[model samples]
Target: MGQFTPESLAASGQAFELTTAGGCGVFVAEVHGERLWIHGAGAVGSKNLTQDGLALFEAMALAGGCRFIRFETDRPGLVRLSKKAGFKTRAFVMEKEIKKC
Candidate 1:
């Protein structure tokens, strides 16, 4: 697992941490117009990671004062968890690396 520094999020003023009885999660979010965009998240590997992540999403949404929340993930587990948390997949993202000339 990677290190979780809540200080980093607090200093940026664009992120927050959410802790529940199950576990804890760190998320970076920003309010864009009418939406709360969750840039990324990280948490310890545990059976309750999904639940913790969902809780974090809700907290971020409420704090951002946005009705819509958006985030992207490539991890299959997270995809499933997000769906279970009532988030629908809107689009798929693809990327390619450019070779230096």
Candidate 2:
């Protein structure tokens, strides 16, 4: 992921795994107040990207004491699926890369 690496996640103890219909995959969790942030790897063949698998990740977040779960993504398919899964768009994140000057 552009925002996180395996090394960073492993070092921070924020990495978690889920068992999907296809296989298994990983997710990263960050808790803020009662809210939890998590997302599954979207890369194909990475496994656990299915809906049931992702739901397991959400369940983990809630079980970990988070009342809300949030994740950032730019994928249209994922966005649609999330909406079907009852996730509402709370905010939009915009970014501009600042090149070396």
Candidate 3:
């Protein structure tokens, strides 16, 4: 079983949208304005994950009142999954962490 710790998610600028029973897997997100960014890896070939994944992602965007839902995944399989769920690759963003002295 896997867990999506709130502390870790929050630190990563993400939110936990949903999780499976017995701590199987979780659907996490990074909300920016109206965007709910999801980054999850569930059990292999789990049908529940496939269905719940799409629903959860859609719900995230809707709950945030977003007109568009965007996701980024370098994994070709994951990208295909997102595309099937009506998402498209838009632009890329390069991020760098800053530390305060």
Candidate 4:
């Protein structure tokens, strides 16, 4: 995975940043059909990370006319927060690297 700067995200016109009193979050979103898909996001490791992220998601959904928000993350803390935000696991991804001579 790669990290994105707020300026870069803004240049792409598909992402935004949410800054709260306690922390800040970066998110990238896309509207497809009736749902808003959050391709990626990251927040400073603070107590308000979850709050900032959720608020950003809601704002994007509202502005984009999307009925739902979808995103993926492997962080355990985020997993727990996602559950709190009413998200359920849909699938798991596994990968391995192969070396060639």
Q: After superposition, how far is residue 76 of candidate 1 from its true place, in Å?
A: 0.7
**Candidate 2 segments exceeding 4 Å error:** 1-3, 43-48, 98-101
Give Cα distance to truth, residue 53, candidate 3, Å: 1.1
Please list all clashing residue pairs in model 1, or write none if there are none.
none
| Residue 26 displacement in candidate 3 (angstroms) | 2.0
> Model 4, range 53-94, lDDT digits (tens) per residue?
776787778887888887778789888878887778887889
> Considering TM-score, which of the candidate structures 1 and 3 is the better prediction for this target?
1
TM-score of each: 0.71, 0.73, 0.59, 0.75
Report, for every candidate in turn, its global Cα lDDT versus the true structure.
Answer: 0.73, 0.70, 0.64, 0.76
The residue-by-residue lDDT of candidate 3 on 8-48, one tens digit each, is 65667554534554234554566677777765534444555
Q: State how far residue 51 of model 2 sits from its true place (Å).
A: 0.8
On a 0 to 100 scale, what is the lDDT of residue 49 in model 4?
70
Estimate the TM-score for candidate 3: 0.59
Name the weakest run of 10 consecutive residues (lDDT summed) in model 3: 15-24
Model 1, 2-89: lDDT tens per residue? Answer: 5646665555447766666666777787777877777657766575867676766677678768788887788898888778888898
**TM-score attained by model 4:** 0.75
- What are the per-residue Cα lDDT tens digits for candidate 2 across 1-101? 37866777666447766554566666667778888877445444432365765586578777989888888888887788788888899999999988998
Clashes of 2: 0
TM-score ranking from best to worst? Answer: 4, 2, 1, 3
